[model samples]
Target: MEARDKQVLRSLRLELGAEVLVEGLVLQYLYQEGILTENHVQEINAQTTGLRKTMLLLDILPSRGPKAFDTFLDSLQEFPWVREKLKKARKEAMTDLPAVASVRLPRELSLPAQL
Candidate 1:
């Protein structure tokens, strides 16, 4: 994941942990997309509370490679509000950067909507 993306996740950690529902479909989706390995899913699922699960997910996602951010974003279909928050954060983070620095960053990827 990009530094900016990581930063966004960090910034929203509290909100996400409070709001994200990771017990069922979210975890399944991420695992299916290859963003979360079986071990990762097990580790996250092992957490006792929703907050812990989400925090673990946030911690794991940054290390999951470049596609992790978008794949995770896609997995947020069950929580469109969270997805919008992330997209807005990403856009805001990009615009806050200096022109040259922003230019060096990867462009925002357009992801297909979850049906």
Candidate 2:
């Protein structure tokens, strides 16, 4: 996942932990989507509390590669408010990017210099 997406997840960690039902369909969906491995699901299910399970899920997501964020978002279908909040955060993050960052440099200028 992108750094901005990871940051958004971290920012909403507390809220997510409070609202996520770790023992429910979310984890199964993530596993089925291939975003979470069998081991990952097992680890999360082993957590003693809902909050701990969510925290572990949050911790694991950033390292699960690019599609993890979106797949995870999709798994939140039961929690429309949480999904909306995440979507809004993503939109805000995109808008907050500096205009200069979106401008592509000329090929020659974009090339790396020799050491």
Candidate 3:
């Protein structure tokens, strides 16, 4: 396994799920490679931290030394288990409200009627 792959695999082993950082980057790269669907990216965007950090991770990866992440990603194309997990995670995320969604507007506060 590539080194980055090991880190990613280890994280999954520990949590039984994807690392937010790693998953985001993999999704971005796959999108760039034209292997991922736009709907999937949109769904991921609604659920994940915005793409900036994920982009940064991909941009900086060459400097982080070797990793197994590439191999794992390459294997995703044929890995039904990984794909099932990804779909399930996405399903769960779609139902999860954004952090800000819980902060409700004041019920009694009114906005000025006139502009």
What are the TM-scores, per candidate, against the unseen true structure? Answer: 0.84, 0.84, 0.28
TM-score of 2: 0.84
Measured with C-alpha atoms, the lDDT of residue 7 in candidate 1 is 95
lDDT of 3 by residue, 38-72 (tens): 66456555554534434443333333334324533
- Give the runs in model 3 whose Cα sits over 4 Å from its true position: 1-18, 22-24, 48-115
Model 1 local distance difference test score: 0.89
- Per-residue alpha-carbon lDDT of candidate 1 for residues 1-115, written as tens digits (9 for 90 to 100): 9999999999999999998569558889989999889999989989988889999999999999999999988988889998999999999999998766433433466454565
User: What Cα-based lDDT does every candidate model obtain?
Assistant: 0.89, 0.89, 0.47
Per-candidate Cα RMSD to the true structure, in Å, reads 10.7, 4.0, 13.9
**lDDT for 87 (candidate 3):** 47
Better of 2 and 3 by TM-score: 2
Scored against the true structure, residue 64 in model 2 reaches a CA lDDT of 95
Models ranked on lDDT: 2, 1, 3
Which segments of candidate 1 are over 4 A away from where they belong?
101-115
